[model samples]
Target chain A: MRVLSSNLRLFWQGTLLSYRALFHWLRPAQYVASKVFMPLAQMFFFVFLGTFATSASNAGFYIIGNAIQITAVSGIFGVTMSVGGERETGTLPYLFGTPANRLVTFFGRAFMHILDGMLGVVIAFAWGVILLGLDLSHTDLPALALTIAVTTVSTCGLGLLMGCLSLITVNVMFVNSFVYFLLLIFSGANVPIAELPNWMQAISYALPLTRGIAAARLLVGGAPLADVAPLLWTELGVGLIYGLIGYVLFSWFEFIAKRRGILEVF
Target chain B: MNVRVLFKYWRTILIVAEMTIRQQLMDGFIIFTVLFQPIIIALLALWMLKGKGPDYAIFVVVGSGLTGLWSSLLFISGNSINAERWSGTLEPLVAIPTPFEVIIFGKNLANVIQSLLSMVLGYIVAAFFFGYDLTIVQPWYFAVSLALSVFAFISFGLIIAPVFVMNPGVRAWQNAMEFPVYLLCGFLFPIALLPGWTTPISYLLPPYWAAVSLHGATTVGTAPNEIFFAWGMMVLFSLIDLLVASRLFKLMLYKARADATLGME
Candidate 1:
């Protein structure tokens, strides 16, 4: 019980400090611009392009897909930067020096981002309904919310892996932006999954957002939670796998850096 | 920058541009901006527009290329000054005998020239991979439009770089600015699809005119008068942009020196 309480305190502090130490430092104006305004602009561009490709009737498909995909702004970039930032800000040495539980520390970094990413998705959905004529008359509100949460967590899981890769790389933004844009293609955000070529489809399933997007589309089309539960479970499992891989990488990196006495970035 | 100054420092400008190109080619972010991002966007546009028929191949190629140009102009050229400051070179660059605007112009020139490669790559992707028999309907007119568009974009970029450096609040919106221009400028679609109020906004943007003339020249049956009007708008906007950028650079340099912020953020 003492150990459990101690770990909880470490988790909370890590979440808060890392969240605060984010590159932008959480200024409200920059936050809204990067998190709120930028994602909407991206969503609108694809929504319009999708409509132009097919027709206005298909706006919901693009809207829902993109609204869910917008979570990556926080999930990929935000979470990666938070984890990667530990190294960039010279905090990794202190972090590894502490006797704190690595599992709690590793997962704690993504805690706030999961919530932040969910809010981003909510805002995108709100914009969709307000401006783009997205009707939620038949959507199961709870199921849709769950979908948003799960999807965000799943994307943040991928971000964790990206964050680990970022620890070893200097071109983090390049990799982050590439994966973010590539998601717009492979995640069925703009183009339908069925329409993608066989190889693309294979990749689409392997990624996080693809299943979550399809599941959300189903619920929005009036399907029950039971119908999309498999996809949700699969999404959760995929996230767990990625998160576990990220944890392994983080632990291994710490061991190697300490062994080689290259723990601190020069 | 005065036209006379550009002519007088033509050799310096060329050297700066050559060095910038050599230096930035290794930068992953710049390489993505000038190359891969545009190609990926082109691929997405092609697959989305697959049902629209073969003629759209060239249109997607040019539109995605324009997206790259605007993105590079906004992000790369927009932050060019900040980049120098971050690297601790802005002060030396400013202290040099040569005019600061000339160096920035050459940098923007390098950026715009490198960006044109995205168009060529987009064209290749459409022709070879997508198997679209794409051809420019009016080669000579298209060439002229391309030249004017490059001038217009560089001039516009000149205004953007200093303005962003001078206004941190405005720079905060830089991420949100890219797609709206793409939407408003009709980079991927006709502005007629947007609401009526946005037409004037599109007309005010130099890239819209670039798109107008470039798209017009690429497709058949556009009136020569329409194309001429677009070219005229390009020349007009470029002149106005150069005028605005001249004052901006002067004021920026004055403020930076006065406040001792040139070496600061």
Candidate 2:
């Protein structure tokens, strides 16, 4: 019991410290500006020009698509880049030197990333509602929140895995670019998956973003939470599997790098 | 004095450009990702339109061609700037007597040549695989539109380069711009497929005009004088972006230099 209590305390402290570090790394002004401006700019551009391709009834659909996009951009890109940065800056070594459990440390940092992703989503949702004049009543709020949470956690897990595998800054950039293209192509971010080819649909179904977006659409189209239960369970299961795999792989890599004395190559 | 300096350094710039091109090509992964990926995407679109008329194939060809050009330009310029900045070489290069404009101009020139080559390769592959009949009735108008769009895109790239220099975390912003442009710019489908409000915003982007002009040139069988209008708009946008980017680059230089000096202490 005492050991468990101590571990919990350490985890809490690590999470707080991670947030502080991230806050320092990302200046407040820049964070606020990115959170506010990016979504607003996208809303304006999409709402203004998207009408030429589709219609107002589908504006709601576009808003939901943009939401998934915002999550991917903020969670996958933002969280993974910070992890890679920490590895590059030699902080991970000092972090590992501490007596904290590695899993706790990993989850703690991931918790902070989830928080950041949630904040970005809230800001984007607000921008979509207020600036773009999107109708939120069309969406089930609880399911939307649930979808965001699951998607963010799953994406952060993949990001953690990629960050562990990356050797250089260019590697991170390449991975991010590749993932962006893959997600956009497969996730039905711009068009319905039903409209896509069978092979593409298969790929989309395999991605967390696709499930999350599907659940989100159900919520946005005014379906009850019970209707989205399958989606929620699928996302939760996939997220846990990916998160566990990532945690194990990262721990193994850290062990190897430390044993080889090449941990500080960055 | 100017002529002498130009003559002295011009050969060095050409050599540097050549080396940059060689290094980029040697990276087979990058070549495949940047060049072949677009062709694959074009083929996918072609597959979707397997039973459509030649007009639809022509539309896909033009859209894919423009998309290929935009993506090539964006990835090369953004990634090159990012690589230089992250490698800590940009500061040293900027600290030298060479004007920053010249260095940036040289980089843009290299990127343009690389992107043009990639576009040509992509077009040929797309044509052979997809059975696209690319007719060039108003070659001059098409050329003019493409040149202007490339210029505007380079300027847009410069405007965003300072962000990579300042905060590497914001590189996603550079990419986030591409998604909307690709979907909304009437690239794979007509702009009319989008909602009513999206058309004007698409018009604002240079790629939309390039695609529109190219589509008209290839399909309408007669060159509309509107191609000149698109070129004029692109030039104006290019000039504005250039001015803004120049100012931002200067600011980035001063700030980065100060940060470096402080760290040295």
Candidate 3:
């Protein structure tokens, strides 16, 4: 009980501190512009293009997919920056010297981002319904919400893996932006997965948001929660695998840093 | 900001442009901004608009190319002065005998010129990968339109660089500003698809005129009068932007020198 209580406290503090440190510098207006307006604008652009390509009736497909994909704003960039920022800001040394549990610290970095990412998706969905005339009358709202949460967490899982790469590279932003945009294509946000070539479809399934997006689409199409269970489960599992790999990488990096005395050398 | 001054320092401008292009090529972020991002956008667009048939290939190529141009202008050229400040060269550069705006013009020239490669890359991708036989219907007209669009974009950038330097709040809104312009400027699709209220806003943007001219130049059936009108609008905007940028540059330099905030963010 005592160990659990202490770990919980550490997790909470680290989660809040890292998130604040990363974004609190931006004024509220700037935050709203970046966090709120930017994703909405992006959603509008794709939704318009999608409708133009086919017809106005197809707007819902893009509205949902992009709204869900917006979580990656928090997942990929936000979470990656939280972890990578330690190295960039020269705090890695102090972090390493501390005797806290590495698991708590590592996973804690993504906790606030998961919640933040969920809110972003929710906002995107709200804008979709309000501005773009997305009809959700038939959707199982709870299932769709579940899909959003699952998708955000899964995307953040990939973010964790990308964050570990930041420890060794100076071009973390480049990597993060590249992966984020690739997800825009590979995850079936803009282009339909079925329309893609066989090899591209294979890559889609390997990605985190693929199942989550498909699941969300089905739920919005009025499918019951049970119908998307397998997809949600697969999405969660894929995220777990990525997160575990990230953990392994994080541990390996820590070990190497200590032995070689290069905790923040790069 | 007088157009004549640019000609006076032509040699210096070219040297600065060459150096800026060389330095920026080595940066991964710049490379992604100017080249890879547009290519990826083109790929996604070609796939998304696949149902629109082959006529839309040149549209995607040109649209995605404008995306690269706008992105390069917003980020790289918009930060030209700030980039100098960051590298601790702003003061020395200002102290030099050459006019400050002249050097920045050269840098913008490099950024805009390098960004054109995004269109070339998009053309290749559309031609070879997507197997679309891309052609410019009026090659000379398209060439002239492209040159005017580059100058207009450079002039527009001159205003943004100083404004962002003077106002960090405005700079913070940079990411949010990107896609709206792409949408408003009718980069990939017609702005008529947008609401009626946005038409006036579209006309207010220089890139909208660029799109009209470029897209008009690509189709064999478009009226030459429409293309010429777009060129007129671009030239008008360029003049207005240059005048506005001149005032902004003067005010920015004064504040930076007076407040001793040149080295500060």
Identify the candidate with maximal TM-score: 3
DockQ of each candidate, alpha-carbon based: 0.80, 0.18, 0.80
Candidate 3 lDDT for residue A73 = 94
**Model 2 residue A157 CA deviation in Å:** 3.0
Fraction of native A-B contacts kept, per candidate: 0.70, 0.04, 0.72
At residue B181, candidate 2 shows an lDDT of 74
Q: Is candidate 1 or candidate 2 better by lDDT?
A: 1
Residue B203's lDDT in candidate 1: 95
Question: TM-score of chain A for candidate 3?
Answer: 0.98
Give the CA lDDT, 0 to 100, for residue A47 in model 3. Answer: 95
- The DockQ-based CAPRI class assigned to model 2 is incorrect
- What CAPRI-style quality would you assign to candidate 3? high
Q: How many backbone clashes does candidate 3 have?
A: 0
Judged by DockQ cut-offs, the docking class of candidate 1 is: medium
TM-score of the second chain, cand. 3: 0.98
**Candidate 1 chain B TM?**
0.98
Query: Model 1, clash count?
Result: 0
lDDT of 3 by residue, B1-265 (tens): 8989888999999999999999998888899899999999999999999998898999999999999999999999999999999999999988898988889999999999999999999999999998998988899999999999999999999999999899988988988999999999999999999999999999999999999999999976999999999999999999999989888888988998999998888
In lDDT terms, which candidate is top? 3
Q: How good is model 2 by TM-score? A: 0.75
Per-residue lDDT of B191 in model 2: 71
lDDT of 2 by residue, A1-266 (tens): 98889888887887777556654644565555455455554544444334433555667666676676566665566656656666766687887677778887777666777867766677777877875667778777877887888877876766666655554444566676567556655766556788777988887776667777778777877888899888878876766776677678778877887898877774
Q: Model 1's DockQ?
A: 0.80
